[model samples]
Target: MKLDNLYIKDDTRNPTLSFKDRASAVGIAKAKELKKDVIVASSTGNAASSISGFAASAGIKNYIFVPKTAPEAKVTQLLVFGSTVFLVDGTYDEAFELCFKAAERFGWYNRSCAINPYLVEGKKTVAFEILEQLNFKVPDYVVMAVGDGCSISGAYKGFVEFYKLGLVDKIPKMIGVQSEKSNPVTRAFNKNTYEFDYIPPTTIADSISVGIPRNGIKALKAVAESGGFMIDVSDEEIIESIRILASNSGIFGEPAGVTGFAGVRKLKKLGLLKKEDIVVTVVTGSGLKDLKTAQ
Candidate 1:
């Protein structure tokens, strides 16, 4: 909270109104390159709607699997895009596994964020855009909510690629935030281990309610190698952050999307963030995506 400069990379303005659009766009392109006509994906809400929208625009077929508890607004988006939607009656982890197996069995291109390497390549563009918007100046810290871990990992990869190309002199510390009720990545970081056991998520932030983070190792490495840390915020904190961000900055972020800002406040309270540091927190999705909780 004492940072000299604080910025929010508002991805809610994307075509699909979420940061997942970045990866979904790439996935659709990759499916074409592979000569695949049908793409399959699993998500809580954001990724499903994103891929569904892109697939519709591209005239390609898409099948989406999401937990039955996914926000109605997101489900409506999928239906509007004419995607084959399966409301899986289980947790997000179960839906992901189901989609994974189905994709393999049916030879459909899997667009799941954590499983597809190419999708992460798409996600890296967020980092590129952030630096470009900042006049190619890297911030002291880059914060984002972590679910299956692909987004944060991709952001870190982007920064490292830019650093390798001398586009930037340094990589910002990659701070990952998760809901305390669904915090496998944060738990692993706290334990100083990469291996984490599955812990059923019970968070109100459906977008980040991942029990078994599919890309957990990469996310852990991203935080550790960047000399950053992982943190968890309560659902109450996430809700308060949504209000704070909207009222203070006029940025309406969903519960999960604003989780990083919650972690930032927590870190400041814990005396971990410095007054001189510049910080950037990514708002991954629009508040409209989960209006029930936002209200």
Candidate 2:
């Protein structure tokens, strides 16, 4: 793809090696402010690992629930961070429900991205950074992989906030990418509906394999209100993007992390992206987080 200016907002460089760290940082901080001692969350991998790492540094107790299929590397990170890990013998959605109930029962602060409003506050900082780094010049498009939809919504919120404050003239079109094998949001957008039915996801991009997106409404609004569209890419495309991004840009990312780049490629091939358009694709996680899949 020969776009005029395509930038990669590489969140893989975060402390916990994923974009989830931004949310986790805020979640942890909120828990401390609330005087909560224990925090709980459910994730495919990144969120659990991120919160666990931050909680460790903050001396806060954390309980993480992940599906049995969660990548071993992430599980190891959770354990290493001293979190009480629950490997739910079911899908991520099941794990999420269980974690939610557990949090309520135990009175632990829930840090799951979709359920917590404050987490998005931290995630929105990505938009601020992108604008600041580019000397406040807004890009034509901002793309990222959508999991539970919280990250994309956060980004939209950030841009909107900046616009409200007259810090920027316009907000970029927010493009949300999903795996073809697990694309409820894309399906909903294509159908022009806001309500999305649960479609059990079976994608190799574990981080984005959400069947029932908790923040689906906000994500759909982000795409629609910003004059953006949702797109789904094949797993093969995502894997290939990992290689392409690394070989060309020296940026190594996991499958889900590179999904946005894959979408950018697809968009260009489909004639949706103009050659003169400035685009930024957010690489949300490090390849090291899922070494086996990357290999």
Candidate 3:
């Protein structure tokens, strides 16, 4: 709230209670069109649940790989949706590697955003939805948490699509937020470099606890092309922002979901955001996804 003229896009209301639903919806639709019989993806939690649910609806087999540290609720959601869940006894990066290998070997359609371009294409819908909600007005900044970076990159693509269609005059600056514990993208951005160096995650926000983000290249491109920046927020800041968002806006988001709000506060402290500038922060997931951490 201190960031005056700030708006929140409550993507937590999406089916499966996270922004991944949008991406999964699109990916599943495309797979169905291609007559694919199975879809596979790796996620700490949200994307797995989303893909499982969407693939179930489409009458396709779904397989998901998740780090063993992923929350129980998310795993349960996948099981309830009939997904063949693989709990990798390693980091999210390992899970992603295994998922990709399996997808390739089995000829299963990969629904992972980092591996597949169509997932980003689906994720662009969020930007379209936000712009339509705001009556086609482009805000000064659009902020969101990044893990594999598909969401923000897709958002940039949506803005660019609108710009190409002459529906908007300019694209908003994309401000990507990540946890300091798992911030390959932030490290790359801060160092003014593009090389990705893996760092094992040590944060409680499991959804964004990716060490080596597969979409690091595209994510870096989104920030640089849009004249945007990536910032890292501490776990303490993320937890506090979660409570703050729920208290002030009645939006109960998981820690990763409120990570960008923490970034907005940081930007305000640095005097980067003006009171008159409109800022929109995307809340990417529901608190229910990680209720144990929320407590």
Sort all candidates by TM-score, best to worst.
2, 1, 3
The candidate 1 region of ten consecutive residues with least summed lDDT is 1-10
lDDT of 2 by residue, 2-120 (tens): 89889999999999999999999999999999999999999999999999999999999999999999999999999999999999999999999999999998888999988888998
How many residue pairs clash in all the candidates, one count each? 0, 0, 0
* Comparing 1 and 3 on lDDT, the stronger one: 1
- The parts of candidate 1 lying over 4 Å away from their true place are none
lDDT of 2 at 182: 91
lDDT tens digits, residue span 1-295, model 3: 3655899999899889999998998899899899998889999999999999988888899889999889999999999999999999998889999999998999999988877877887889988988999999999999989898888998999999999999999999999999889899999998888788877789998888988787877888998899999988899999999898899999999989999899998899888898889899999999999988889
Q: Per-residue lDDT tens digits of candidate 1, residues 92-177? A: 99999999999999999999977787998899999999999999989999988999899999999999999999999999999999
Higher-TM-score candidate of 1 and 3:
1
Q: Give residue 239's error in model 2 in angstroms.
A: 0.6
TM-score for candidate 2, residues paired by index: 0.99
- lDDT agreement with native, every candidate: 0.93, 0.94, 0.90
Q: TM-score of every model? A: 0.98, 0.99, 0.97
Error of 3 at 146 (Å): 1.1
Model 1, TM vs. native: 0.98
